[model samples]
Target: MKRLLPLLAVFAPAPAFAHAFLKSAEPSVGAVVATPPAQLLLTYTEGLEVPFCTVTVAGPDGAQVQTAKPQPVPGHENELAVPMHITAPGKYVVTWHALSQDTHKTQGSFSFTVSP
Candidate 1:
């Protein structure tokens, strides 16, 4: 039994470390809304490098949406947001890349719909 226990210990999962994990989004990732949002918001699980974070928004037509640079909230390094110019009701794709204070890089994308 001791031998089995030692072997099992070697295969056990390692402890998790901090990373800039996408915890949630303002549009709620894959949500459909009745109106277009004037901005994009992303919350991470760890403090992020504001200068290294980036966000890109695109419409279903494949043209990029005019968005201001992403900025971390003043008191919340884990949150990022950008001003968006939403014109019409349609699908919008939001893509973001983040660099945590620990130097870990993470990225993801999702789409949401805007209906009148």
Candidate 2:
């Protein structure tokens, strides 16, 4: 029983190491929209450290599109948003790096099309 108790203590904090993952997005992954979205919003499974996170948008031509730095959505620590200007109609790739409040880091990318 003494050995079992020590083992349990070591695993008890495993959940605290959980990494944040993309929960959803505004234009959503693989979405085809008729009009260009004015902003990109990303939601994560856990609260993020906005100052240590980043989100980037690549335009249809593969150039980095101009966008405001990602900001935490007001009143929502797990949600981040960036205002973007998109004029062309094509696929845009969004890549993000997230640092969770607990300090775990994660990253992912997805593309969406603007048909307008």
Candidate 3:
């Protein structure tokens, strides 16, 4: 019985980790696009805690770009769409922070270039 108890405890199913991680992004990481994307699209590995998530866009000179608040993509709680603007040819950096429904938080940054 003692052996069984210890064995059961050791082999018990573990809780699954549900951290929100960037799965993929539009304008793709380090991509050079002929046209600037109207919005930044981010897909995450888990459903997000919308109120706790944020996305920011910055221009080549590290100036903040005016952007609308991030919102859940229609029919997709795991995706957030953030409106952005890039008026001239330059590199843009996007930084995002997400809090998953599991309460885990994750943040990351990536850059993309706009060509003339």
Among all candidates shown, the one with the greatest TM-score: 2
Off by over 4 Å in 3: 1-13
lDDT of 3 by residue, 1-116 (tens): 77799899899888576789899999899999999788989999999988789989898888877378888887899999888877878998889999999888999999889898
Cα error, residue 71 of model 1, in Å, equals 1.1
Per-candidate RMSD, Å: 6.2, 3.6, 3.9
The models' CA-based lDDT, in order, is 0.87, 0.90, 0.88
Error of 3 at 114 (Å): 0.7
lDDT per residue as tens, model 1, 69-103: 89779998899988888888899998888999989
- Name the 10 consecutive residues with the lowest summed lDDT in model 3: 63-72
Per-residue C-alpha lDDT of model 2 across residues 40-71, encoded as one tens digit per residue: 99999999999899889998889876477898
Evaluated against the true structure, the overall lDDT of model 2 is 0.90
Q: Point out the higher-scoring one by TM-score: 2 or 3.
A: 2
